[model samples]
Target: MAISKKISVLLNLADLLAKNKPEILRKNELDMNSFADMDESMKDRLKVDENKVDGMIRSLREVAEQDDPEGKILYDFTREDGLHIVNRTVPFGTILIIYESRPDVTIEAAATAFKAGNRILLKGGKESFNTNTYLTELWQRALSENGFDTHFVEYLNLSRDETQKLIKENTHNVDIIIPRGGDNLINFVTENSSVPVIVSGRGNNFMYVDDDCDTEMAIRLILNGKKRISVCNALDKVLINKNLPELKEKVSDFVSELHSKGIDVWGDKKAASIYSEIKETNDKMVLFEEFMAPKIYFSLVENMNDAIEMINRYSGGHSAVIVTNDAEKADTFMQKVDCAAVYHNASTRFTDGGQFGVGGEIAISTQKLHFRGPLGAQELVTNKWFVYGKGHVRE
Candidate 1:
């Protein structure tokens, strides 16, 4: 399909969603009511309301406004034998995105893949079947109205066994698969998929407080990172330098702030000695845990090197932050830490596609391959090499 037609369809779909807000919300309500056994975190991700609808509309508009990602020449050259060669971006043919709750993906992922000229097949969890079905219907209507094929975007409501069979069998000739959810889902897709898979949506992020850090600013950063616990980029572990001046007082104030916010804090012996209320645990496994709730794990580090080592060893390679006034130390941390997004004296909460000014995202990729960090529309495409030759044969 033409890029203009694609953009028009997206804009029209945004308008349709905005106009049919009530109907959409009613369908979402039915889904929400039916899933009474879900945990609070899952519900938070599953529920769809006016604000989320607004976000979906905004994402569609932004994606439509961006330039077409396909057919852009990345490299052009000629050989001595008069053969022309060029490398340009192209769609992946078909992309399969398997995700759990978070109906927003139904719009963002589909819009991104479609705008890039790829067929998208969304396999969402059962908890969001109603909402996803309704959204897919709207997409079909938009495509048909714009004189485009409805096959551009499709939704698959499959059970666990069916999903596994689809992945293992590759019945649809999927070019790539993106799995966005907890570790279990990610592992299942990674182990079972016959196609190339992009691993995303796992966040065991960390933050370190340096010896010369601004204690007050550190507190603010910590609070911001913990504000939303259901997201992948939320902070899970914190490492504090034990040699900092007034360490006990700072730990006490930090603990108090976390407690006031009803966050459960677990600390090492050094931090536990300062804050008696903090539950003490010496388990190293906590360092690798991704707490998608109001919980945090704390430990004391000897110095900058120790902090960096710990962060690199335990982080999910999603995001890591270092709060320090020393520019040299911050630079070192930002460079040495192996993660998709690294921050210096800033909150890890800014690790988002929209926040990074890339429109919306399909997922926050944690693996290093074609792309890492947020998978924006532009990142959804791969390149193809084109060669032109007339009567030229290999010698």
Candidate 2:
């Protein structure tokens, strides 16, 4: 397919979605009405409103406006045998995305893949079947209007067993698999898929407040990190340097602010001793858990080394942050932390495709194989080698 056609499809789809906002809302309502027995956070993800629709539209338009990623030459050379060689970007052929909730994935992710000249196979959770199918219809309509095959984007509404079989067997001949959800969904894909899987969406992210850090900035960052509990970038843990000046006073101020916001604060022994409002815990497992709720964890570390070690061991490899005024300390933390996006004197909440200026992302790839960080349209492609020889024979 021509690149122009791909861009047209995305822009047209955005217009279609914009004109049919009511329909999208109605479909979302249908899904929400039938859905039952889910946590508030899950419900928030499943539900789509005017703003999310606007966001989807903006993402489509942004993607359409970007340069085509396909066929960009990486290298060019002439061999000694007079053979011409070139390497250019190429799509992954087909991608299978298995995700939970968040029907916007049907729009944003598919637009990116299709823009890069890849067929998309989306398998959203059953809870979002209505919205997913409706959005996919828009994609098909856009493709058809542009004289392209509707199969460029496809939706798979399969049973749990069927999804499992497809992942394990590669029934659709997909080149890459991206799973967007909590650990369970990501784990299932990584452990069972026949093809390479990009692990994403888990965020037991941590922040370290150094002794020399700006106290007010640290507190502000912690609050902002918890601003949205349903996102993968939400803060889960905070490790304060034990040498922080007036540690008790600063921690108390932090706890008081969090309480005013209705967020639950959990702490380890040292942390709880500093703030009476913190609910202390000894369960080591909480450190490994991604609390997609109005909750956060606090622990005190003896030094920068201890803080870095703790973050490396317990974080979800999604993102980590260090709040410090010392440039050297910040640099060391950013380098030593093993997360995909490390922040120095910044909030972990910025670990997003849009924030990182990728238009939008298929996923924030935590694994480092093909690509890392935001997997945008450009990142979604592999490379191909092209050679031209004029009847050259090997000597």
Error of 2 at 190 (Å): 1.9
Per-prediction TM-score: 0.97, 0.98
lDDT of 2 by residue, 1-395 (tens): 68887888899999999999999999999999988788878988899999999999999999998889999999999987789999999998999988879998899888888888899999998999999999999999999999988888999978899888999999889999999987787778888888888777588999999999889999899999999888889899999999999989999999999999989999998899988899999899999999999999999999999998998888889999999889998888889899899998889999877788888788888888888887889898899999999998887
Off by over 4 Å in 2: none
Top candidate when judged by TM-score against the true structure: 2
lDDT by residue (1-395, candidate 1, tens digit) is 57899899999999999999999999999999998898767888898999999999999999999999999999999999999999999998899999888889999988988888899999998888999999999999999999988988899978788888888999878999999888888888889888899898579999999999899999999999999888898998889999989988888898899999989899878778877977999888888889888899888889989988998888899999999999998998899999999999889999988889888888899989989999888998999999999988889
Error (Å) of candidate 2 at residue 215 is: 1.2
